[model samples]
Target chain A: MTALPMEAEILTRREESPGLFTLHLRLTDSAAQQAYRFRPGQFNMLYLYGVGEVPISIVSDPREARHIGHTIRAVGRVTRGLERLRPGDRLGLRGPFGNGWPLGDCEQRDVIVVTGGLGCAPVTGAVQYLMRRRERFGHVNIVQGVKHADDLLWREQYECWDRMPDTTVLIAADEAGPLWPWHVGRVTDLFDRLRFDPAQAIVLCCGPEGMMLAVAEQLQERGIAAERIWLSLERNMQCGIGLCGHCQLGPKFVCRDGPVFSWREIAPLLRVRGR
Target chain B: MATDCTLVAELRFLAAADRQRLIEALREAGYAVHGPRVQEGVIRYAPVERIEDLPRGWRDIQEPGRYRLRQTDENRLFAWAAPAASLKPLVFPPREILFHARRDADGRLRFEAADGAAPKLAVLGVRACDLAGLYLQDRHFLQGAHPDEAYRRRRRKLFLVAVHCAHPADTCFCAATGDGPVARYGFDLAISELEEGWLLEARSHAGQEILDALPTRAAGETQRKAAEAAFRQAAAAQRRRLPGGDLPARLGGRLDAELWQAVGRRCLACGNCTAVCPSCFCHAHVEETPLTGARTTRLRQWDSCFTAGHSLLHGRPVREDTASRYRQWLTHKLSGWHEQYGRSGCSGCGRCITWCPEGIDITAEAAAIAGEEA
Candidate 1:
């Protein structure tokens, strides 16, 4: 509950793309490391020694509580500084905060994960969870879209998922490059080719607000209930708890109430600009 | 929490001249006394060691964007409705270091939290509206699943002395909010000022002990009546009011109202109103690193929705314009607060109205959105 930072050492580091990197960290304190547990969509306040903190979604599987992995894009001041750290470098960590993706609710239903831009990181853990317990769930569909083909990461992982039974992976790029294998269009365009029973499908979406809104609208048009559609939101989450008041969407503090919320819960506020 | 009627019935009279004894008693009991005093033509909370430190014979005239202090021949203390600031600064400080991250010789980084112990504070001359604001702050910082450690440490050591507001100002509207003119509860001692003396009552066990130490007598029927009349007069003098009953729901339905754009044009987004607000609790984190590069401290300072950075996401503001920012502040205070804290965030103390550089009256704005006049 305390906002104070816990020391964490970077166990491993990987460059996923030109600007995107992944850091696998382990809490220096054995007790804290052993006690730590997180869900797919929950985020941690990652602090670089002399820099500041930023809310980064955990991308590693929840079952492996030993080391946590976060896929981060070097965009802002904090993340850019975090990108420079090596495997042995130390940083401050404070979370496992915000509500995560509703993996439990999708046990017997088909799960559709729609992501745009660099939004696939938060749901990567959920997809892995479903893959591990493939018998517990029905069909698993993941749709991702990026500005350019060069912007996409984890190409091998996507190819591997596409080969699995009862699992479907579709990727799109707005400005397609040479030898691009996926579709060349917006994420919403994927729905025209998508096949599923709306009544048995649970859609989870993340990305830019416009993309999420479009995704939700397309799902609604396909007869998906708003209650069955969830989204991971983004805001200025300085405090992982609700105290900072920066991540408010009307009455909901996105950090406390959700990074993941049903479309039914945020539909009223999402459309209202500046809410 | 409302004051018990039975507790008020047992009121004791403390003469106007004997008020210094109460301050002395609190000081002797290991409390640092802070009370209202005239500073720079405005009433502010400051250190008080003697009765003379209180703003006696000074009446504050408050209006939209204006606050003036006038001295009269009258000797009554606490003639003003409210001070420029609330007791929030004493508990939840405007800026505080959350923790310090330091690197040792072994290249190990360590985080140490700021000191948790706080001085025992006895704050006098608390008005009912401010008390209500503090109550909401209590629920916000202390009643949640993750209670704020710094705020909790300071709050537990506070000994409050409530002063009933006998003279409500033009901007006052605590009565409409059902908060006060008379002090209700949440104080160690409640005092109702009268022409001759003060009617004092103890609401807590510590307050009873403090009352027992002071030389006091049973209040005469006439004195009690005079105090009750003062309370009534204060309530009746308030000219500003907000539409009562289910304001949260009502404000929710008015999200698209055109009033927001109209007010946004005038709003400078200077954030003065929020700085003076008793109940607003938005803060932003900052990092401070010394030139020595030995340690960096993470501090939090008071922040407002009016600031673009408060809602920033990847260097872009979620609330891009003043209209939306204004709506966010207003709706969150009057509407979203109900969902988060189970009540309206505003205590109706009128500090925001009086301190706003543009003279943006919240009561009038709320009423306008409700299709009513100011």
Candidate 2:
């Protein structure tokens, strides 16, 4: 059977920022709820009646099998329709698709997460997972960047992450006022303030393509192998499966082969224009 | 398998009059037979009841941006290379309702999937490139991690009868692609037409049973030789051949070449190349809801890479200009496709060349790029 959206009810809705909200959904069918399980960095195709479907990453803790959480930003027609949804409203959902972050590979190794603006939503699940099993991993470093202080999401959660043992949270803004308590520069500048052995770290970065490319290049200059750096990419997705050729980035289908890929695999294609 | 090969070797001659009997046999075996017929002054695939429905004594002149049908005095069943349409529409409809949802009496929504069973269909006069295209589509829709239920249902009930091309079109390059002039596999029954009669060869158990039911006599050695010579002539007559050696790698390296901009100037981004392409399978989804808002139906339609919306990540499109979109289509088809599917995406059917309004030939573009690098 191909991807068909199942009816789901919104259990709760929380607004993290203006035009950005998180919905906790439960599949009406109990059997389907049990069948649907996702890993961190995987996404679901959320559908609204009379509107279209859009791919959103699952931010809920993976251990919770009953309720699925998705962070959505009102950017397009489908998302704008989704923004009007209330706690009791119903919606359609399919997937838990695409390859997720390689959590197992980070075991016994120091982990570094670099994100910008709304890019943190996709990797939030991975961060939560790592914190739950903190002893299994080494140093946990998260570096986030935003244009202004108001753009920061999950502020309370970032505070909680900082309290965890052996964890480091670094936040930066391009233009900061008195209210902001972080460095006033780009995310790459924060890398200078932190200290870590590049050989022992696995870097996971997601943001605009230009930002991610800059981060990857800087990390490579610091002696990190290209293979150890992983990045999450975004593209126009219609079908969550690989059949629809819309999400193609060179040979890889962002919807299927990845929304997450190692830098080594996509480096050549990234250099080409329009690819 | 050995027995089936021997059955194939036991060739039979099907006279022009006996072709009607074959259609009758197919209908009697619970299949709705479909074939090419003249519609809107052009030959198109449609339901057929008899041999008269075929495009008999008709041939087409196809060039870049031009197609014209001319009447011929000679009587032949399969003279055209292919119509504007391929097996794509039959298996993957242009628009299909994936499912429907409606509110129930309890104020909860109920969903039901689309119908699964499809009618048994026997399509006659399928060209070799179309047969190859069908196999390629099978690898995509059926062999994937999540098989397309609708495509699988329709494909399961299909019975293919392939016809060897005796007259290659001006835009045809199937000989270079190693896909045509003769049907190799993926067909139940294949036919090679000669001046005297049609030589029938069955390649499957079901095909053997159908051949047994038909009234046919053993094909003579002279008839077999004539069929072989005709296929050879068709292959030799091809005017276009893709440049040899590592096409995927060569095209990938030329992403910054100036040739794409020159081609993009003439290219209208009209999506006709992708629409006529036998292997293009991109699609977009749409939802329909009545004023009542009680029910919603989700449907999928064919999409093309030439459109600006094809690469929309958020509100912004990655390939915002015509040059980039054209480059994406060509690079994906000739170069990137090999990395993803382990095979070249183009079947070299030349439909893109003939149907292109700007007369842009892929073979010529590839040659120009390849020659510059060499």
Candidate 3:
């Protein structure tokens, strides 16, 4: 016979933004274990039978596990299958597979995080890592963008970030709103607002390919060699142990080598087409 | 010229009447016998009760996606290439167990092994190309780093009765892959059926043991000669021939070529090409939860590369376009697989072409590569 889902019930689910949601799964796996053991940016392949399985990045921290969480967007069959689920229901699971962000590497440099739209999921882990140990790093600046005010993933967090001392949050949207305050242009135009020493600060950028390309290019222009910039690559990753050969942008197995890479590491191998 | 192999055990031929006698001897020896019998216009393998169940004077012709049998005046056996269904499902069941589990009343969890004891299978009629396929799959699921233990258990316990091909079909590409038209390995007994009687040669002790128990006599040189002639005729009948020894290497180099897009335009990406093929062994897993809400993770199902989820991510599919997906499948088949597995994944079983809704021929694609070079 099958066992129960767990003792803890879901607190609530919040729509962070379009294609991104925060599901506060009740920590029924174990209560003593506050947070499930997960590294930053590691993904869970959520399974829903009658529909199938789809992988979503775990945006929560290992230190905080009141409920399991993910920023999921509806896309294909399985994700669409999941979007239809109401508050309380059984969810199947396969893994927290693949390598997450390097927790050990974040301590030394002042962090410059740039994210847009759904790309915020992976960055949230790094954000939680930094916020928990704010003094370990130097200054922290987060530059984020979306299509509109509604596209902003975490408005509360952004407001919280705007309040923090030594933290400069540059928020932008693609099109201007009559009441929209901070900025009213593509996030790429906000490059003038960023402080770049290149050596002192490590830049990590994630978002749509177009924005990633633009930010990465902007960083390269700032005397930050491609090696200094880390770009999260997207590929179709199934069976995160590198068994399924799904996401091969080239010879690299994105599931194994990275969903993250230094631009210099992949730049030569990456043959970008003319824009 | 060498007339026999070190593994070959010579045995006597049974007259037409002694067929039942030998069958009875085998039944007494505790074997579940299976052999070919004609039904519904084709030759099919069924559990035989007596020697009479064997298809006599039965011959088959295989075309793309179809198989048919015809009666001949001469009662020759081993007159077909191979069966429509592969031995792949027999060794590696369509769905089989990875692990079983129960969530205890205390809310604790326990896991159990699902696959039971392996049965001793007496496989009566696997062809040469099919054996090569088994050999190939053995490298994938059996001999690989992550060995499929359940498959290994079943394989080690089986009794193979290898039947040589006396007729090749249009889809047979065994000649190119060096796999065959006849049984090559793990066979207890190899039978090259002749018009007068079967040329019985035991390749292992189990086959000899079975022979010793049966009421049988020694086969003469004339009987063996007739069998060889028939075997040659089988090889001659094939219509498709995969060209060159460098296929594994050649196919590897062209993975990124735009030719894949060309092929994609025609492919439905249904994965039926791999499904019916004798050599393809990709699989998926599922866990069944009872009303009690405990889960049992089952490694019990077939999953094809054609599955969107197999290569999708972030609700964004990796092979978002059917064209790239097509490219990946063919590239893996012809080239990329050799990098990881040391051989092309194809077994020259033309079922992929025949069963294809588009009838996309790999031979034509291979020729296309060769043509571009010349």
Per-candidate local distance difference test: 0.88, 0.85, 0.66
Which digits, one per residue and each the tens of the lDDT, describe model 3 over residues A1-275?
11122233335677655655566565445642354467776776665543445567778776765556777887777676666555665455544565666656657676788998778888888887887788887777799988877677677888897787677789898875788777887787887777656776777788887788888888788767787678777776544544445555444556556777788876643443210
Q: Distance (Å) between predicted and true CA of A196, model 1?
A: 2.5
Model 1 chain B — which ten-residue stretch has the worst lDDT?
B1-10
Per-prediction DockQ comes to 0.77, 0.72, 0.14
Tell how far residue B98 is off in model 2, in angstroms. 0.7
At residue A157, what lDDT does model 3 achieve?
89
**Selected candidate, larger lDDT, 2 vs 3:** 2
Candidate 2 chain B has its poorest 10 consecutive residues by lDDT at B1-10
Candidate 3 lDDT score at position B204: 82
Q: In terms of lDDT, which candidate is stronger, 1 or 3?
A: 1
Residue B54, candidate 3: alpha-carbon lDDT: 73
Question: Which portions of model 1 show Cα errors greater than 4 Å?
Answer: B1-7
The lDDT, on a scale of 0 to 1, for candidate 1 is 0.88
Task: List A-chain TM-scores for all predictions.
Answer: 0.98, 0.98, 0.87
Of the true interface contacts, the fraction found in model 1 is 0.76
